[model samples]
Target: MFRFEDNKCYRMPAHFGGFDCPGPEAALYYKDAVSVTFTYTTDEKQLASYVPEGFELLRPELNISYSQFREIDWMAGGAYNLVQVSVPARFNGKRDQLEGQFILVVWENKTWPILGGREETGIPKIYADIEDLHTIQPNYYTSASYEGNTFLRLELLGAKPVNGQLLSEMQASAATINALGWRYIPKVGAPGADLSQPILYPQGAEVHSAWAGSGTVKWTQLSWEQNPGQWHIIKALAELPMLEMAPVIMAKGVIILKPNNGRVLE
Candidate 1:
């Protein structure tokens, strides 16, 4: 149970579950977001092992992004930062249409967003220290690190506004690129039940945003440690040969968490 008194709210143990947790307690908005996309080639067989049976790898491309928020609803929201890694993929053997980029991992500095995202969408959200600091005019630098190990470093030079045509294209792409996740349900021991086959649910999210831009992207991956069980595939990606890096596509946007209505493949 929860109670609001004297302009403050308190949460009890009973108020848990049922999507009744306190908050978004705050809303977030960002004006300037720096994102960098890195496209690299990897072994097809290795890539295929990570996803579901029918899902297909669209391309050997990987995108890593870093952004610092300009506005946050909370009082202590001082330049919150985020870093994410994703790969372009298609679902159900549909090579003609891009299902969207599947998020491999995500790191952020805040707690509420991470908790909410993990619970709702099954996105692997972890806590880390991310900094987007400005050392020189017209040039911004960013880095993401965890437990004294720096994994990502980037430098954006000569930031500028995106063109109208490119911005519109980006918005359209953002709308179509839904967030995908893998949900697992273990089998229960019941009478005459099929215990060998577990349940898997493919989840998706509605993505909506109106802002995007581009800049010269100079990025480097310092380390890729296998800290969690689900993210062990990152080690294989780190072993792949370094291919050309794509121009950074930056966007300040919002991701709407909708109920899981996506197709469930048995």
Candidate 2:
């Protein structure tokens, strides 16, 4: 007979074995993280349709980011890359009201982080082959693809270092780093879910340098033949109308991922 224990972490093949749960102080450290991010206003109604219930769209803005991560602690100094799509939203839960960037979709180059992130912290992570950052002095570029078919590309042009006072002001005006996601696990041979809820995953960053630049994002409409499982996702995002574009930012920083500290929203 098998019995589940309390205060323990489990994943697939749980009946076979178990591992030590990391403490609250545990963090996955990221070194030499370079990220290119840009935000743009889109159609309010269309964006709202994608957001789950109990969430209020803070604005019409949508953000797209591509990052290169190296020297990871949990992977024993391994490296990977990722791309993210998110929107500003406020969750109106029964016991709490919180504001954060609600992740629409995230694609990672490796499988380890994807599985752990989705199962434990509720990040909507998927797989993509993200290329290393391509730089030509003042310009930086990267792309994401599935099965050798490129689906998205990101670039920052004319990037220049931010001055002391401006960087301070930008940091001061930044909002809290509370990331939101929806966790859903379907029951085997059933139409309903075994578990479904919203999650609050908090994280922090220690920035070493920052740059302001003209950022550009290009999303390719994927076909079933190109990306069978994720064609729709790419198509939908590619259809989002870009109403207004904001300045693109390139930042170098150390990212702190707190998987143990993540919690379910009430």
The TM-score leader among the candidates is 2
Candidate 1 — which pairs collide? 1-15
Count of clashes, each model: 1, 0
Runs with alpha carbons beyond 4 Å of true place in candidate 2: 1-7, 172-176
The lDDT per prediction is 0.53, 0.87
The residue ranges of model 1 lying beyond 4 angstroms of the native Cα positions read: 1-45, 70-79, 93-98, 133-137, 158-160, 184-234, 253-266
Q: Which numbered prediction scores highest in lDDT against the true structure?
A: 2
In candidate 2 the C-alpha lDDT for residue 137 amounts to 78
Lowest lDDT 10-mer window, candidate 1?
Answer: 196-205
Clashing pairs in 2: none
- 142-225: candidate 2 lDDT, tens digit per residue: 889999999998888899899799887666544237889999888999899998999989886777789998878888888899
The CA lDDT at 167 in model 2 is 84
All candidates: TM-score: 0.64, 0.95
